[model samples]
Target: MIWRVATLSFLLTLSYLCFQPVKMEDGKEESMELGTQSQSQMDTSDSQNKGSNEVEEKNPSVEKSGEMKPDKTESDSGSKPTNNEKSANKTPEENMVEEKKSEKTVELKFPTTLEGFGYKFDEDGKLGDIETGEPFVFKVRSHDDSYNQKRYEALGEVITEYVYELLEKEANLKRVHIPVDASEGEAQSFIFMTEDALTNPDKLLLLIHGSGVVRAGQWARRLIINDNLKSGTQLPFIKRAVDSGYGVIVFNTNENRIRQGDKFIPVRESSTAVDHGLYVWEEFVSKSAARNIAIVAHSYGGVVTVELAIEKEAEFKERVFAIALTDSVHSLSHQEVSSSVIKLFKRIAKNWVSSKEPLDTPVPSRHRYECPQVSAGTNKHEETSWSSFESIFEMLDKAYKEVTEIDKEEL
Candidate 1:
């Protein structure tokens, strides 16, 4: 009777435990319907706001020279046309006017609009939606005027700054401001590096873009602002370097001044391209512990590197390993390169120029003074950046390996 009573009590306890309610973190016993309820709430919210999101996506932000195109009218389009569908020759106004001239005047047929694209047909038949009747903030280059130069300069400034933002966000690179010639608490300019590139020394890849409007992380401003992001920015170069166990530093050799609050302060160390590049090299690059350093410079950047090789003779001999130039504009006319320097440079540097010539067709030796050039497998000057990427890395690898081997042999 005792065993029977104990067994019955144990079965009752097990049944009670199995049927107990589930408690939440807040100690409230929630209904099994809570999950379904939450899901239903999500479905309802998404359904409610889906239209607005679609409307926002339809309103594209596209403009050339900040010209406020008259808001498109219902009569202007039979159906909303995409960039590809639109006529190449017709203006937006002309397209609308064409749409208004219907073949059957007696029967007016209103075309159905795409979802989210709203066209307001006011009583006046004019476009109801309009942009601010304002000109672009600055004038860009035109065939007719010189005042447009400032506008071009401003555009370059905007592009260079935007490129920096993309580099950090897209490539996840870090920025460090190295004081140009000033001591602590004085004026400084910036250079970009990877997370620990400054401290780690294994392999360092320094990226220097061409002169003029293009700043660090870009080869051309027009492509960056006008073309696709991948074609414009140096994110590709950064990623490749990171993958190859190389720390990267994007040199801002052209930014001679920095903004402080409302006023702009000139860097004490840098006033020109040569000044800035030399300052960055002496202060930051010279201090790195990397056994070898490689550089990828484009266009006028080649000239800057050539100057560095000429000026910093001892430092270049000790630390530099490889240098690649895309469509380099380095010339003997600008400054003379000694025979000894040419011999030192030819061993590691390869100039990739925009030409129809073979990739290895040597630039005619100019009295053995100027650096020899090679075709980067492209003829377009601006396209050299994108075209020479593969060739640049190949040269860097071969030269870098040779450098490492020599160091090992010495060891």
Candidate 2:
């Protein structure tokens, strides 16, 4: 009887050892059955979550052990979702944008945020609408084309004026009036000045608007007319320049000639773009104790820049640090861009051109001899400035640092 009891006890010990849970590193005693159950529950939870957008839905199996699974939905497959699924993913802002885009008229609200580009997009990566302060996007639904054109033109002018006024109101900007040719008769050349810029500035950034109806603090006239302030105006650039410790100069080259005495004459203080640019450099830029000068010019402003550089080669060589031009119309053919000028440009200028390649990516340029031409990372002619702003400024900062370092080393 003693031997039988011992055999029975030994058999019981072996059975307990065989069924014991493996000891975990944390000294937790989990039964093998419990671990198997937990794993089964996890697998079930994952299966239940497959392509299901419902987050709070609890699995029935999870209530007992933690999991559930259902038939694979359309979202489970790695293939494109159906139109109905796309509609289901639409965000509130995206829906609003779609509704707004379809309407010929919308109540526009001025943008108050700088976190984003102010573009509304859907969950599926579709651009919905843009926020521009214009009250309506003019469209001629009726047959009166002439009347429609007139209506839009007047509205566009109003918006342009409104944006310019807004720029004038920015705290960092100061309005500096330059005298045009005394021959232009009482006309004044205006450039926006940032705070602390009237005196000697260590860094000066010149902002030149494109040609035509555009004025100071503007990149393109149609950006305001067709798009919004974000696209049309240079406020973003101005804000950035000011933040980056640069004295901002919004060059109003196109606003040189005015009608003061009946006949169109250059304002008493005004000159044409070419002459006005030169005059500004001589009077304000050259005189400013700016140790380093950089220029950001768009469109025809390139002509003004190159002409100024060629005219004031000595000043340019001595002070101008970098030049960033967007969709510049100035070509080397216009002025052979002499070897000396080309060398200076190669050392300092970066021409932002509209190309399919990514921003700042170098592209083959017919005028590479003039300067470094690269993709502004956008195909839109007007958008080149904004798209390349961060990248271009980064380059400028790097170059500036190098120059400063070299100066320090020389000392």
Candidate 3:
């Protein structure tokens, strides 16, 4: 009877342990009814979120244990959702903006270094063709002024170097660095010249570009960006000069900053446009052995030439035979040029000013003491040099013939 009683007690205890409500995995002793209520609340939350554009709706699924969990909707094959499926609710404008952002992120990424831009100087300090095949667009965000300015500055420096290389390769010109100031210690400005420029050529063509960011061989960077390189660079003029048997000298007037290590220092002596012009005229143009020198000055370059004439009147009168200007900003009164120099300049020089009139048509002079003004065939400031290119060569030819005829008569 005792054994029978013990067995019955053991059986009852085992049944109680096995059948008692098991604690949820969540450590809460919630009933099945409570779990069902929680799932119902999650479904209601999801439905409410779907109505608000600001709220993101989440997929809810009930686990085997009857607990609600956030779930991702997948295909029967268990594949992830496509980008199209994920962005299905986006508006057309939003989709277009997103696509543009994606494209900019991927395609518009640019390198921050010179070599990364596919330009490298060789052992001889000469750059070869760009290997990366990247177009130099100079495109920057308009909202960021300071950042874009710095970027444009860096790009301008690299473009100057590339143009220097082009002058050597395409135009068959040699680079000559003349010291502008001995006090500044190695402060010098370079110029491009033909091989026979200093070897006593009969006629010399001095090509002087405008002020600002333009260097020795560039007419306008804007044209390089918007138009073709042939219209933007001085190679066409150099080629024409060579074909006409004239030695070319391309002056580097705007290189007022020299690179030292990784930083740029101001070339104080040649810093100002007039100072650079004076120094180059004294050190380079006067030193050349060419007999008849003609100047093709553009914009501030015309001002430089005027200053040159004022400073070196004797040498100017003796050698400089003709001056062809394109949109010159020369001011005889502002520059304090002498009356005698002004009269001589007026006789020898002609300006191709930007105007809407026909090419080479006479335009009324804008300044009191100025050269004869003629239309450049274009109304744009930067387009003047290129548009007046053919007319300029013709003027040079006529001047050379007239000057040589006078010289022969004197002989």
Candidate 4:
């Protein structure tokens, strides 16, 4: 009778343990709807729950400290936990926030140098295409001219340094700094020349650029920013001058300011455009022992050449065999060119003015008696130098040969 009672109690305890309710971590009991939920439905529900947990771990808020937040149930929003909360607790608002954070993290990095800027150049050095790093600030027109000028100057500074490096390395030019002012010994202007420039070769070619932010080895910074390096810079000109057995000197006429200690100050002797030209000519050009000289002047450089001629008339006429001016801004009355200088200009100089006509085609006269005008092929002012490059070289070569022949005959 005792054995039968013990067996019956043990069986009742086993049945109670098997049929007990499933208690969750939250202390709430969950009952499975076995009849309504199939095997596929149960599997799908588990997968959705696992996906929510993975998203919470992997997709942390980038805007925040990039840390994962603790899991929150429907109870956090002042609502009772539902059966569906087990699959996914994220609201529509939470999903949208995560999407926005991911979008905000994506950014494009702009390049610092021209080589890394992803621009393509053609054989003639024209800009074929741009893949990246085009600053949009330049495209938008501003009402303020001064503001635009400042921006362009800043951009030109970077390009100027790059061109200076190219001049030293690629063109094999030496940079020489000359003190312009006795008071400010540290503040000086610089020029680039061949090794034989000071030694005075048989033939010398002097390149002078326009006014503005253009430096020694640059024709136009605008073209460099918008076009290609070849069209904008003076590397091609320097190379041609070297290959033709002529010593080259490129003037940094526009670089009038030098950084002294803590502040930027104007070079004493080269404070103005004309003054700079005068100082360089007296210090370098006049001092050189070159037999025959040639000048290639562009824009305000034409003004400088005229000033040099006026100041040193006898020397200019005797030494300078050729003068090629591209869109020269020289004024006979404004710059006070003398009758003697006018005669010299007519004898050896030719102005390649920007025009729609073909290259070397005669254009209308500008003054009573300045150098004769010919079409530069391009109507653009900035492109005049590069467009007339070939014609100018041909004129220089012909003049050089003729002058040398005349000297030989005299001897």
Candidate 5:
């Protein structure tokens, strides 16, 4: 019975030992699977960290490249710019600068400001005060006949007397008269200075006379006709101009004998009255010390005035702010005048052919028609004429009023 019990105990112990070993083996296998899973998770975490670090390092480079790119855009396929994208991308300042540059390149070249008249470069490529060089020397030429000579001399005397009276009567003007000789059968050019006239450098009056009329006599005589010289005359125009301060100078283109002819006569091309007038203007009036001047031309005087204005367009553009034409012959368009009357005059005046006929005359058309083709090259005067002198004065008042209005606006 003791032997049987010991064997049974040994058997049970052996079985227990075997069961324990199997349980230990199962635990080892579970632990091994858990360790492998942890190792795989750690490897995956490290790979993700490295990828994030690389993206952070490259971010600034991508941003800099985007800023440095030219004005362009990529399409859905990343090949070309899309229209909608282009519209949204550009800045307003860039667009404005481009538009301004285009306008400046295409704009017409014309005078736009006051400074442009004085300082702007001309087609000749010369600057201000460079072309004239020095003051011009005036020379007198005679075309006077015996009858016209006496008439001119008497006219001069009448004018000189009237001016002397004006100097005495008008307290504003300090007048000095310097007489030149007309004994050579030529019309005389008188130089007069007024202290009051010279006081205003900004404003100047250039009084130019028409054909068959001497400037020296006609200028003052017209004042008499207008009653500006008489005590009863209001003289408001003169007073206002003087009060405003202006320099006044008169030029006599018709003082020459060629201009005083009783009838139209064709003459040598060079000896034409127009040629002489142009010569006188270029040499005398254009180079005068009075830099700023406004022309007031009467009758055929418009011819001479227009010629000078056109010839010196670049020089006198600003200075010659206005041209007042009174009873001017060249103011009317040739088309406006009767062609029959023109034909009749041509036939009648044809008999008086001489060596001194003006190039502008004896033609089928009026003086204005010939003006464009003359040595003057272009016409610059604004035409103002009426059927009568009364109408002319009315227009003059209107013109003066308009000028005053413009001055006010500028101020």
Candidate 6:
């Protein structure tokens, strides 16, 4: 009977142990289900909070929950967050803020039209109507007899009209008028040159206008006519240079008025003026195939032209055959002349040093002068003088003759 009782006790204990394991397994499954439900609730709460924040940013101060008190009162009350209350919590707006700081900076490249590069000319490479072949003309003159305020105003009106007409008529050449301060005065100018003039030898001739003549619409018109005629009196120097197998282009310097002392007008440095001219020249060059260039500048343009030559001498020397300056105020420097002596000796020392070497070893020399090649002329009157147009013409003619002679000798 004792043995049987002991066996029964052992079986009972073993059966209880087995049943305990099943009960523990069922409890673990229930715990896992509770954890999963908790996680799902948290995820749904986060989504709802994000949506609420977005709405608050748009509307500001809209209640998200019916039971919630005012934000300021809830902050002061120090209430503990319940499980449901925790679900409504919103992330700080500062954390949600999109910084929007650009990590990749974009560089802008300007647009270039076929006409923008100076390609507006025809087979002859002239600035005329493409359909009719008739050269564009302008009435570029002062408003009245005097070079006073009224005269300048009238001049400005004419210029405006001419520019409008040119843009309206020419589909090939695009013109942009960069305006300075209108309140100060009428400071505006335009650029006109064939896009292919720099690269195409058939289209060579970069024309840069000097101070007063730059704004005169007649200057560009005359230049165009001269270019078309190829033997006209308007730009005889340009025609001569072109005939000698050189390309031409033109730029308008910043200073447009002829008045001697205008405080309002800004005085540009020689370097700045030259750079502006060159900037336009390079634009034409980038689009064309012609390499050889001859720059023809008049008066103040002379200074601008020389600056460009000096600045781009190494590059231009191989390509630019010659530069013609007409009645220019600026002086030229010799290759041998040092910067220290340039101010005192001017062109004389520079010329002497350049010519000194070639004199002793000449084999039937073609160039007659021993000096650095420069053709300069001056009218007897002061810069402010309104002299006879004939005297100006004579000075220009003599200067042209000297330049051609130099070119012939050098070539």
TM-score of 6: 0.36
Best by TM-score: 4
Candidate 5 worst ten-residue window by lDDT: 43-52
Higher-ranked by TM-score: 1 or 6: 1
Predicted structure 5: clash tally: 8
Residue 119 in candidate 1 has what lDDT?
25
In angstroms, the error of model 2 at 212 is 1.0
Q: What is the TM-score of each candidate against the true structure?
A: 0.60, 0.64, 0.66, 0.67, 0.34, 0.36
Cα lDDT listed for each candidate: 0.58, 0.61, 0.66, 0.67, 0.35, 0.35
Give the runs in model 2 whose Cα sits over 4 Å from its true position: 1-135, 180-185, 261-263
lDDT of 6 by residue, 1-411 (tens): 465334434432322222121112212111111210110110000000000011111212222333344445345346865433553464444222211111013221221332321224455646443454544322111121121222223333343344434433442233444332234444444454433444464325555544432331223322232243221112344334344454444455543332445544433221234555666655554355664455555444555555555555555544444444333334433222234333322321111111112222222212332223321111110111111123333433454455557668999
- Tell me the deviation in Å of residue 311 in model 1: 2.7
Instruction: For model 4, name the residue pairs that clash.
Output: none
Error of 5 at 198 (Å): 6.4
Scored against the true structure, residue 343 in model 4 reaches a CA lDDT of 82
Q: Give one digit per residue, the lDDT tens place, for model 1 in 1-411.
A: 465334434432332232223344432222222211110110000001101111111112322222334345534555765333453457877654544343123232222321111222223322122242121222222221222333334444554566678678877887777674467767777878888676667888888875554567876654443344465568788899999988888987767777888888888777556677788788877887776788888766776787788778877877788888776656534345566677777777777766656555555544455556676555545556777788778878888888888889999
Model 5, range 1-411, lDDT digits (tens) per residue?
465334434432332222121112212111111111111111000000000011111222122212343345554667565544443476766644544454345522332331332222233322222243221111111211222223323433444444445444653443332122224444333333345344554666655544432333243232232122331111233454455455655444433433436643222221323454455445545555554455555445554554454455455554555555432334223223244333322221111111122322231223433322111111111111111223323433454556668778999
lDDT of 3 by residue, 254-313 (tens): 788788888787665576666777877777778888899999987778877887887799
**How many clashing residue pairs are found in candidate 4?**
0
Candidate 4, residue 390: CA error in Å? 0.8
Looking at model 1, report the run of 10 residues with the lowest lDDT sum: 41-50
Candidate with the greatest lDDT versus the true structure: 4
Ranking of models by TM-score: 4, 3, 2, 1, 6, 5
**What are the RMSD figures for all models against the true structure?**
28.3, 27.8, 30.0, 30.1, 47.4, 35.6
Superposition error at 261 for model 4 (Å): 6.0
For each predicted model, how many residue pairs clash, with residues at least 3 apart or on different chains? 1, 13, 0, 0, 8, 18
Which consecutive 10 residues in model 3 have the weakest lDDT in total?
42-51
